[model samples]
Target: PGQVDFYARFSPSPLSMKQFLDFGSVNACEKTSFMFLRRELPVRLANIMKEISLLPDNLLRTPSVQLVQSWYIQSLQELLDFKDKSAEDAKTIYEFTDTVIRIRNRHNDVIPTMAQGVTEYKESFGVDPVTSQNVQYFLDRFYMSRISIRMLLNQHSLLFGGKGSPSYRKHIGSINPNCDVVEVIKDGYENARRLCDLYYVNSPELELEELNAVSPGQTIQVVYVPSHLYHMVFELFKNAMRAT
Candidate 1:
C-alpha cells in the first residue's frame, strides 16, 4: 500500500514529438534540460519500478525479470541520490550527466531480457489465452514506456554529452523535424535483411513502393526520432522475413 501510494504521487508526463524536438534542440545541455531531467526521470523510473513489481509473481520470479527489477531499483536510487544536488555547478552537472549515461547503457539489453523472461515463463508454465492476452497488454505498455524513457535519456546524452552534432540540419537532439520516411525504412530493411541472411540460406529482397503519390519531387517527411523509426521498421521487416 505504501509503495502504491508512493508510485501514485508521481504521474508520468506525456511528451509529444514536437515537444521533444523543441525542448531538446533548444535546451540541449542547458540548465533547463539538466533540471528537467533531474526532476522528471526519477518519477518515470519509479513508476516503471512500480509496474514491474505488479507483474504476476510467476513472471516476476524469472531470473531476467528479477535482474531488470534490480537495475531499475539501483537506477532510481542513483537518481534520487543526486536529486538534491544543485545543477547550477558545471562539475555537478557533468557528474549527473555521466550518471544518466551509465544508467541508460545499463538498460541496453532490456528488450532481450524481458523477452527471455517471457520465454522462461512459457517454458515453465503454459499461459492460457486470457492470461497470455493480459500479459501481452502489459508488455505492450511496458515496452512503450521503455522507449519513451530511452528517448529522453538518449536525446539528452546525444545533445549534451559531447556527442557529435546532429546528422541532419533539421535535427534537434536525436529527433529530426523532417525525417525522410523512405530512407529510414530502407535503413531498417537493410539491417533486418542482413540479420535474416545470416540465419537463413535465402533471404528476401525489399522492394519499395510509394503508397501515396506526391508531386514530382516532394518526399513524405515526419518529425520523429530516426532511431526509433528504424527500430520499428526493423522489427516489422524481421517478422516478415521470418514468415517468408
Candidate 2:
C-alpha cells in the first residue's frame, strides 16, 4: 500500500471569482477506483465457486462487473493453461460491489455454510499436485490487491461525501535560500533543486530511452521507466547532501 503525502504553502493572492460553475464528472478518479478493485483477483478455487453459487443469476447484466470479470478469467486461464470452460468453471468472474468479497479458510466443503463478509466454495474442485500450488498463489496475490483497491475507492468516496469546502492547497516543504526560480518544475529538475539545491547535468545530455532496473532471465519481466539521466544524477546528489 502507498501512503499519501504532498504539501505546499504560499501567501494568499487576492483574485476575483468566476461565474456559475459546471464541474463535469472526473473519469480519472472513477477509473483509478475500479482499477484498484480488480488489482487482485481469482481468489481460492473452492472459495470462488462457493461465491459464484451464491451470486444472483441475473448478475451478467452489469457491464462493468462483466468487463473486469471476463478479463480476470482470461488472464488466469492463460497463466494456468486451463482447458476447462464453463460458467461453473469460470476462474475470473468473481467480484464484489458495495459489499466486499473476502475469504476465510475453513475445513470441510460440505458444512452447509452461511453468508458473512465472505463465502467460500470449491469451483475447480480438484487439480493435479504440480499446478495446484501455483494456481493458489496467483489467486492469493490477486485477492490481496483487490482488497487494497476497494479500500482506496472507499476512501476516495468518503473524502468527497456531502460536506463543506475542500482544501486543495498544498504545503511546500523546501525553502532553499540558494535555490532560484527556473520554470515550474518540469519532470524533477525544479523539485529536486528545491528539495536538494543543485543541478547535476544539462538537460541536453539526458536520454529518454533507458532501463531503471531489469528483472533477469525474463525479458518481459524487466523493469523500465523512461526518465531523465540528468534528473536521476541530480536527485542522487541532492539525496546525499541531506546529512550536510
* Best of the candidates, TM-score: 1
- How many clashes show up per model? 0, 11
Top candidate on lDDT is 1
- Model 1: per-residue lDDT, tens digit, 1-244? 3543475478888888878776766555567777888778877877767777788899999999998888887877777776778877888888887888899999999989998998999899988999899889889988988988898888777777776554644577677788889999999998898989899967888888755465656777878878888988999999999999
CA displacement after TM-score superposition, residue 162 of candidate 2 (Å): 2.5
**lDDT score, candidate 2, position 35:** 38
lDDT of 1 at 103: 91
**Residue lDDT tens for model 2, 1-244:** 0100000111112211110001112232323333333332222332343333334333322343344344434443332332222224223322222222222111112122221111222232334565445445544654544433333333333322222133211101111121211211234544554555434332232223323255433223211111223445557645554534
Q: Flag regions of model 1 displaced more than 4 Å.
A: 1-7, 165-170, 197-200, 203-205, 211-216
TM-score of each: 0.88, 0.22
Residue pairs clashing in model 1 are none
